[model samples]
Target: LNMANMDGDETFESTLLGEAEEVFVERIADDECILIRGTKNHSSASIVLRGPNEYFLDEMERSVHDSLCVVKRVMESKKVVPGGGAVEAALSIYLESFATSISSREQLAIAEFAKSLLIIPKTLATNAAKDATDLVAKLRAYHNSSQTKKEHTHLKWVGLDLHEGVVRDSVKAGVLEPAISKIKSLKFATEAAITILRIDDLIKLEPQKEDKKYGGCMDEE
Candidate 1:
């Protein structure tokens, strides 16, 4: 599909999207290729993954499938969370602020949890071979200032740009995630961690010997 989308009034406010009909795989000139047929609704594309080995193509297929699923999720959800650790960084900031509200020892626990939350971004920075501690400190400072100024209310997509080692707007960078998936993952992770922590059982099982097959009968005799 390569035409402008028109309404009943023929106002061309949007563009048509492409879709596929069928794909045929064949060999051409001793090389593999794919033939794609376009649908009436749109168009089609053919991708032929080539590698030096068979396993490489299989891995490429898996990678392509994962990428397609991610794109589909992003399109369907349309609710974006920061991909470059912005959401986790924001959550950490909120949690730390929330911990300060409680006067009980639970506040310390909450604060610890908040600290743990920063581990995600910190680890990300570390994995990128950047300065994790420095990034984390900068992130906290940025979030704290934002909280005080309420900048987050206006711009809520701040994240640590590991590539540049600076705090930047992730939304503008197009680093996003499906909000539903992101929130659900966080919820499930918290629930799972709490469930594991509350577990106090240590019921170890020991191997038992088999019973004598004819012992009861011998006693009767």
Candidate 2:
């Protein structure tokens, strides 16, 4: 094989050289052509193979399953049974209106039935509290009566009056504590509610600068 072309410099003629030309030719002859050809073919084959096209699809399926599981868990965990009757009633009225817009008449009926079930417990709690308050007031008044009462009846009334008084005092004390404490708690709750409501508002509002004196983007040019 000609060794001059393999050397890098085209100006050097291999035939004119003696021992240097022989050594270069000998080194080139020792290299395995089979090994070089096998390595190049293996690399080309690997590039054409494109192993595991489903790998990304499998990853996306797993991600979707995990996301759906999280959503299902969240929906299952919600246990707050609507507190106020008025709030429930209001929700029912709104939901009823929503049900009316449904394309399916059967679905609208189901929605109405569900809203009716939700309203019952809320109404019961409200009625129970109202009854308890009225009964407590009636017992207090009867016990305070001066006319022709037995000793036990008067004593029972006195005990009832004392219990009512204690409850009244406790409630009054709770109301009278530092206005600052109530104001701070109110402020915190208000701030949290406002923050939740104004989240989208923040995105809509333009950024304002506190100091016009320091100059703005308009002054950059």
Query: Model 1, range 140-219, lDDT digits (tens) per residue?
Result: 77676777686456345678788887778888887777887788788998999899999999999998655589643445
Each model's lDDT: 0.77, 0.40
lDDT tens digits by residue: candidate 2, 86-162: 22333344455567677887666547554553433334434555443443434334333322256533322121113
Residue-pair clashes per prediction, in order, are: 0, 0
lDDT of 1 at 154: 39
Error of 2 at 33 (Å): 91
Q: What's the CA RMSD of model 1 in angstroms?
A: 10.0
What's the TM for model 1?
Answer: 0.71
User: Candidate 2, which segments miss by more than 4 Å at Cα?
Assistant: 1-82, 121-221
Candidate 1: Cα lDDT at 167: 75
How accurate locally is residue 165 in candidate 1, as Cα lDDT from 0 to 100?
79
TM-score of model 2 vs. true structure: 0.19
Candidate 2 weakest ten by summed lDDT: 154-163
